[model samples]
Target: MPKWPDDDVILFDGVCIFCSRWVRFIAKRDTAKRFRFTPIQSDYGARLARTFGIDPNDPDTNAVVHRGEAFLQSDAALTVLSHLPGWSWTRALLAVPKPLRNAVYGLIARNRYRIFGKYDACFVPDADLRARVIE
Candidate 1:
C-alpha cells in the first residue's frame, strides 16, 4: 500500500453516489488539503478495511482515519467535519448520542442506492485533485 501523505484519510464506498457526493463536498471545502481519499474497492482501501475489521468487499460503512485513529459511520462524518473550517459546528450533533446518530446513519447507508443511486464504476477524481486520491 502507498503511504498516505495526509494524516487524515477518508475511506468511502466509491460505487455509492451518496458517498461519492459526500467526498466531493468535503474536498471542495478542504482548503488546507488536510484529507486524503480512498475508495473502499481500491486495493489500499481493502487493506485498510481488513485492518480495521470491516468487510472490504461489501462495506456498509465509511471511515475517517485521523491522528492514527479510525472513526466510522456517523462518527466518521462528524470527525471529518470537525476538522474543516466553519464545519466543526456539525460535530456538536455528537451530543445527540451515538446510538441515535448511528441509527440515522445506518438508515441512510442501507438505502443509499435506492435514494441517491450507485455507479457502475468507482469514482475518479479530476486532474487537479487526482493526487489527493489513493485508488
Candidate 2:
C-alpha cells in the first residue's frame, strides 16, 4: 500500500468559486498547516477520486484524506474544521445528524455552480501558498 503524506488533503471542485473560497478559508484557519490542497481536476486528485470509486469526470463530493482514510461530503467538511485551531466548535454540528447535514450539503452542491458561478479553469494558489498545493 502507498504511504500517503501525514498532512490531510482536501480534494475539491477546482472550477467552483465557493469551493475555492472554502479552500482559502481552511488555509487561513489551519495555523498548524495540517492540510494540503489538490484540485479534483489534477492528475493526483483524479487518481485519488478514482481510487475511492468516485467519478472523476463529474466529481461532486469534496473529500478529505487523513492518515490514509477518506471522509466525504459533510463528514469531510466537519473533520477538516475540527482540526483547525479554535474551530473545534464546528464539530458541535456533528450532533445535527448525518442525513440532515448531508441533505443540506447536497442542495448547495447541486446548485453551487448556478449560485456561486465557476472559473474558466482550475484555480492556481498564490505563490506563497504554492507549497501547500499538490498538482
Candidate 3:
C-alpha cells in the first residue's frame, strides 16, 4: 500500500521527460503535504491503471485516482492542479474540450524530451518529500 494517503495519489509516466519534470514541480510546492505520486511504470501504478481501465502501454494516458474514481490524461492533469495552491486557478483549463487540451498536451509530450529534458532514473524525494512519492 502507498504510504501517502490513497485519495491524494497521482500516478505518472516515470520515463517521460514531461512527467519527470512535473514530479519535481509538484514536489516543490505541495506545502500542505496533500498529494502523493508514483510512476505508471511501477507495479502499483500498473495495478491502479488496470483498476481504472487505463491502457498500461499508452504513454499519452496519465491517471489520477481520487476516492476510487479516476481521471485521465488532460483530466488527470487538471485534477491534480485543482488541488495545488497557486496552480489551482488553472483548473479552468479543464473546461476546454478534452481533444483540444490533449492535442496541445500531446504536442508537448511528443517533443518533451527535445523541448524539456529527461532523467536516467525515477526521482527519489528527499527526507521531507519522500512521503509525497507514495512508494
TM-score of each: 0.93, 0.93, 0.80
Candidate 2 local lDDT, 1-135, one digit each (tens) = 343454499899999999999999999888888899988899988888887767878877998998888888899999999989998899899999999999999999889999999999998889856799887
For residues 1-135, write the lDDT of model 1, one tens digit per residue: 223334698999999999999988999999998888999999988888877777988888999888787888899999999899999899789899999999999999999999999999997779766789986
- In candidate 3, what residue range of length 10 has the lowest lDDT sum? 1-10
Spell out the clash pairs found in candidate 3.
Answer: none
Which scores better on TM-score, 2 or 3?
Answer: 2
Which regions of candidate 2 are displaced past 4 Å? 1-7
Candidate 3 C-alpha error for residue 78, in Å: 1.4
